[model samples]
Target: TSSPTLTFNDGNTIPQLGYGVWQVEDDVAEKVVRQAFEAGFRHIDTAKIYGNEAGVGRAIASSGLSAEDIFITTKLWNADQGYESTLEAFEASMDRLGLETLDLYLIHWQQPKQEKYVDTWKALIELKKRGRVKSIGVSNFTKEGLQHIIDETGVVPAINQVELHPFFNQSELREFNASKGILTQAWSPLGQGGELLESATIAEIAAKHDATPAQVVIAWHLAIGNVVIPKSVTESRIRENFAALDVTLDATDVEAINGLDRGAEGRIGPDPAVSD
Candidate 1:
């Protein structure tokens, strides 16, 4: 049951396989986070917008696992996209999570229209300097936005999390992140809208490996060097997702799955550029 980890630019490491609480209820988040821990998941991703960080904090308190043993990630919402506001939001998030230090803190979205992410990035940089957060990154940022932050702050993000799945491989964005030494992380690793779940190609490969379709997709992300976090409130599904760490996909299988890309239209989430 060994789960691989990826090292961030900050010299800290993150579990490649983790659990996320996107839409899960607060009460259910507590129990389900415990289920994920019991199932061997050492990483947990949450955000201020999730409205369940307190429940997640409870799960951590009851899990009997040391804070150092868990990799927790949370994001700063778009409304909190300025220097002081980001710091305030981070404080609020930390209070909710009940943790002294954060493993990873990210800008949930660029909000380019608001034109405040640069200030947000600087606040994160300061947080890292103060030994508050281990790593800082952005989510749903385009290449131009990423470059702007790096140029303005001269500090590259340790990771860039975006909507990724077989149906929208994000090949170019991943390549760009690689060039900049930023790890690309997959949120919604299973294609949203359930479109990729029923693919015959995926089913065939899953059958060959005697793994579930979800596990096959997760392995594909791992094999490609993308950190993946799949969310599920159901205990069985949480355990099922953790099992993806054990499955290894061959080049042939990975290439076949890569063929599922649906280009720009496949995006189930909003485009970050205009999201503001």
Candidate 2:
């Protein structure tokens, strides 16, 4: 079955469940991405820092699928946050991805201390105007960072991808994004598969639904309306994670998962507020 989609503020729809290639090495990205495609994933999230766009491009080329059938998203590195630099970096990314027009492009981080996100956002705006990218957004942006760019350019981001999971639900951020018509996309949706996956609570819920803990967590993300991209290099795990689209969590299940939020302590990534 096909995964569901969420409409961005710009009217573009992204598959609610996407395949992420964060830690996957460039040499193996093509293989695993192709396997993800075979497992029914239509959206792929990559970044220049990941060093795998070329491999992803190769997979897309060899997948026997049309460009329109896939939603490709990549980001601008922190070092390239100036307007001119962002523009040049984008063209370089396009060359690596081998795409004439990209589906979505994002400023990877707010880099608030540098105070360049506003200008970087303008470059994305210019890309959209030129039809080089269909939609533009940001990742790891705080509410203040988001507002800064919006206040400057009067352009709200279509999406904000961040570290979100049952352990660190990011409810406040999610609420803020919703209030601004922005879609919240989850990065570490499964809590990186350690203790969070082994929790007795998730295990119980998984057993109740006859699904894996990862799937249950993913289902929880969907139940609450966040776009989720779970990553795995193993073929079976890739297929299993994609099958999460079929796992339906009821109100009780979702509430139990919601209670697992660990607030700031559960965040597994760099704090965007202080990140360079």
Candidate 3:
């Protein structure tokens, strides 16, 4: 009953179902992350912008799990999107996380307007070459941005984490990522636990499968093959979301959820193309 995993193009595998700590306070992140571990999540997604990497590191230290037992992913913030700056930021992040080697490191945003992601990606490629990080990838990158990096360096990203949910599935982007062997990771898989969770369709599907609306939505994400990271500060909710690994949806159910896509209107986060 553990979380499933997906392999990156580089041959590294990531847990498909991970616990995310986006808005959790730094002081509280350690407690909730510990709760997530106890609930059986082995992968944790965090970012420098999230401001909880130190607490996350504390939980990892206290969990009694070896470094290889967990998959830890952290991202480089937008402001640090240059060659030397990215390297410095990685060192600072490592100092905060208390880790010698990182599981994955990502360019948190393309920040295309800044016109530095190409060089930023080179730094990540260099990190991978030096074995500082096991895998390197990007987040909030559009297809154009992804192509630009790949064309510039001849290296494809291993993953692309973005805001994805039933409401804003990003089917076209997902297809493009798949075409290039980049695994798509969902940042807001539950749509911030608002209207999407309250949808009549999700409620009906949840009742049909004897699952919570959150689990149903998560299962839908799994069915469509996106790595999902759902965050919750409450212990009970954390455990409940992890149990989504057990929720199985039929083809009909998957089709019904797929029908919920709201196209561009459903996006809840900043558009990567214009974010910075």
User: What TM-score does candidate 3 reach?
Assistant: 0.99
lDDT of each: 0.93, 0.95, 0.94
Candidates in order: C-alpha RMSD to true structure: 0.8, 0.6, 0.6
What candidate 1 gets wrong by more than 4 Å, as runs, is none
Q: Candidate 1's error at 227, in angstroms?
A: 0.6
**Model 1 lDDT per residue over 181-267, tens place:** 999999999975397888999999999999999999999999999999998877888888899888989999999999999989778
Model 2, range 97-177, lDDT digits (tens) per residue? 999999999999999899999999999999999999999999999999999889999999999999999989999999999
What does candidate 3's lDDT look like per residue over 9-81, in tens digits? Answer: 9999999999999999888999999999999999999999999999999999999999988999999999898
Query: What is the model-wide C-alpha lDDT for candidate 2?
Result: 0.95
Model 1 reaches what TM-score against the true structure? 0.99
| Model 2 collision count | 0
TM-score of each prediction? 0.99, 0.99, 0.99
Model 1, residue pairs in steric clash: none
